[model samples]
Target: AQSVTQLDSQVPVFEEAPVELRCNYSSSVSVYLFWYVQYPNQGLQLLLKYLSGSTLVKGINGFEAEFNKSQTSFHLRKPSVHISDTAEYFCAVSEEKTSYDKVIFGPGTSLSVIP
Candidate 1:
């Protein structure tokens, strides 16, 4: 079984500041890591993904994350954020070689950017 945990439920930050969202996962098999962002009342959009190869992965809007195999964690980070960056972030994992027909999502970290 695979499960993902997002440590923060919400992260409030001022515009142009930095932010980080932590995530941890538990799985007995190989897994694929992903971060998704969702605007208000909108569907989730793929921010980044770590399938294999490199541990560090960059995504849209200057967001990036590192996959730590030893810790089973994939944390998202951004150096500077904008009010438009305010949205819900989700971390997810899926077993390797398995179809993502039943992917699971974290509770989500609500990012509120203050102007």
Candidate 2:
């Protein structure tokens, strides 16, 4: 079984402040990790992924995450946040290699960047 956990359900921050979203996962087998962002009334967009590469992965909008195999964690971070960055973020995991593999997503972390 594979599962994802987002420690914080909601994060509030002032504009231009730094923020971090914590995520953890558990899988019985090798897995692929990903972080996705969802804007209001829109589908999710891939933020970053940890397929098979260096632990550090950068994503759009100045977001980045580090894959810690030992801890089974992939925490997303941003140096500075803007009001436009307010959105829901999801952490996901997949155990299969094919594109058709099922992905398990965390409950999602809502980021509220105040102006």
Candidate 3:
């Protein structure tokens, strides 16, 4: 079984400020990590992923994350944020050997960017 935790439910940040959304996962078997963004009235979009390769993974809209095997964490970070970046972010994980659709998602972190 796999479970994900997003420590903060809401994150408020000033526009153009650096922000980091924390995410941690627990799984006995090796798994693939992912970050997804969901805007109002929209479906989840893939922000980044760590399927195997480099530890540092970059995604669209200047978002990036590092896969830490020992820490069991994959925290999303952006040097500068934009007002349009405000949305709900989800951390997800699924067993590597299992179906990709059988993923476990975290509650979510709602990012609010203030101008």
Candidate 4:
């Protein structure tokens, strides 16, 4: 079984400031990591993912993350943030080998970008 952990519950940042959302996971075997964001009253949208290839992956909205196999972490970061970036971020882990595998999601980190 795989599980996800989000280090912070809420992150308050001023506009144009850099921000990082920490995420960690534990699994018996290799798994895929992902970050998703949700806006007010909207469904979750994929931010980035680490399946294979590069350890560093970039996503939409100037967000990026690095997959650290040693640390079992996939932390998301943004060089600069905007007020519009305020939303809930979730970290997920899943094993793609099987169709029955479940995607475990973290509690979520609420990013409050203040102007």
Candidate 5:
């Protein structure tokens, strides 16, 4: 079985401040990690992914995350946030095997960037 758990459901931050969102997962076999962002009334966009390479991965809009195999965790971080960054974030995971190509999303973390 495979499962994902996002530690927080919401993260509020002031403009230009930093933020971090925690994520963890469990699977019997190997898995791929991903982070997606969704703005108000907009579709989700791929933020980053940890495929088969380095543990640390970077994404658009100055976002980054590290994949920890031992800890089974992938945490997202941003040094400075903008009001425009306010949106919902999701942590996702997919099996490495080709049989399952679907991605499973976390509950969601609402990043409220205040002015």
Candidate 6:
């Protein structure tokens, strides 16, 4: 079985302030990790992913995450946040080397950026 967890359901931060959204996962087999962002009333977009390579992976909009295999964690971080960054973030995982990617998503963490 594979599952994802986001410790914080909601995160509030001031504009231009740094923020980190914590995520953890458990999988029996080798897996692929991902972060997805969903703007209000919009579809989810791929923020970043870890298939295979370096632990640290960078994504669009200044977002990045480190894959810690030992900890089973992939926490996303941004140096500075903007009001535009406000959205729901999801952590996902899928079996590696699968013919079709069927990702399992976390509950999602809503981020509110204050001015």
Alpha-carbon runs more than 4 Å astray in model 5: none
Global lDDT of each model? Answer: 0.93, 0.93, 0.95, 0.94, 0.91, 0.94
lDDT per residue as tens, model 3, 18-58: 99999999988899999999999999999999999899999
lDDT of 3 at 46: 97
On residues 1-115, what C-alpha lDDT tens digit does candidate 2 reach at each position?
A: 7889999999999999999999999976778999999999999999999998799999999999999988999999999999999999999999865433699999999999999
Error of 1 at 43 (Å): 0.6
lDDT (Cα) of model 4: 0.94
Task: List model 5 lDDT by residue over 13-61, tens digit each.
Answer: 9999999999999887788999999998999999999997899999999
Over 54-74, each residue of candidate 4 has an lDDT whose tens digit, in order, gives 999999999999999999999
Cα lDDT tens digits for candidate 1, 1-115? 7888998999999999999999999987788989999999999999999999999999999999999999999999999999999999999998886645657788899999999
Mind sharing the TM-score for model 5?
Answer: 0.95
TM-score: model 3 vs. ground truth: 0.96
Candidate number with the higher lDDT (3 or 4): 3
Lowest summed lDDT across 10 adjacent residues in model 1 is found at: 96-105
Give per-model TM-scores.
0.95, 0.94, 0.96, 0.95, 0.95, 0.95
Error of 4 at 17 (Å): 0.6
- Cα lDDT tens digits for candidate 6, 14-93: 99999999999998678899999999899999999999989999999999999999899999999999999999999999
Which pairs in model 1 have colliding backbones? Answer: none
Among these predictions, the greatest TM-score belongs to 3
Model 3, global lDDT: 0.95
Name the lDDT value of residue 92 in candidate 6. 95
C-alpha root-mean-square deviation, each candidate: 1.2, 1.7, 1.1, 1.2, 1.1, 1.4
